[model samples]
Target: MSDATSARCVKCWVHGRVQGVGFRYTTQHEAQKLGLTGYARNLDDGSVEVVACGEGEQVEKLLAWLKAGGPRSASVEKVLTEPSQGDPTWTSFKIRY
Candidate 1:
């Protein structure tokens, strides 16, 4: 299947200065711009967790963005990504509280 038509989901944990830096909001914005669906939220361990589901290429783009560094205020030190295991149910990207 083409990258544009294939569906995929990736769960990423962004570490290092991700919290308190508008990381979730920025991730939501980026996901929306890429037409991906899922959620971003602050984790208890001072990291930001993101679940991106959509076309394979879009998901990869989000991963790349996470690895390259997030929002201007965010100092991304590491990004860990894995294939999401659960069903893809999100219809829109959101910043979860």
Candidate 2:
């Protein structure tokens, strides 16, 4: 129950034991389930970067999930988010290598 104006985007830098634990892939799955479009990748600093764009409520849901420790394998310590206008052109979520 949303319109185009309800769409939003955010960028998150997740810290902790995120990389090497299927974090990016798990994020893709979660984003897809929420009908979000964006990418997740492992940063050189051992953090996971995720950019999600979709309905405001769904995006918020994804943020909560990410903050709550993401996948079972991930030990998310902290997640920093910002209002970054992610690529709405991406029709699906993906794990950037």
TM-score of each: 0.92, 0.93
Q: How high is the lDDT of residue 55 in model 1?
A: 90
Task: Report model 2's TM-score to 2 decimal places.
Answer: 0.93
| lDDT digits (tens) for residues 1-97 of candidate 2 | 5654498999999999998998998899999999999999999999999999989989999999999999999999999999988874689998998
Backbone clashes under 3 angstroms, per model: 0, 0
List the candidate 2 regions with Cα displacement exceeding 4 Å: 1-5
Candidate 1 residue 16 Cα shift, in angstroms, is 0.6
Q: Report the C-alpha lDDT of model 1 over 20-66, residue by residue, as the tens digit.
A: 88888888999999999989989899999898998998999999999
Cα-based lDDT at residue 29, candidate 2: 92
What are the RMSDs of all candidates, in order?
A: 1.4, 2.1
Where in model 1 is the C-alpha error above 4 Å? none
The candidate that achieves the highest lDDT relative to the unseen native structure: 2
Candidate number achieving the greatest TM-score relative to the actual structure: 2
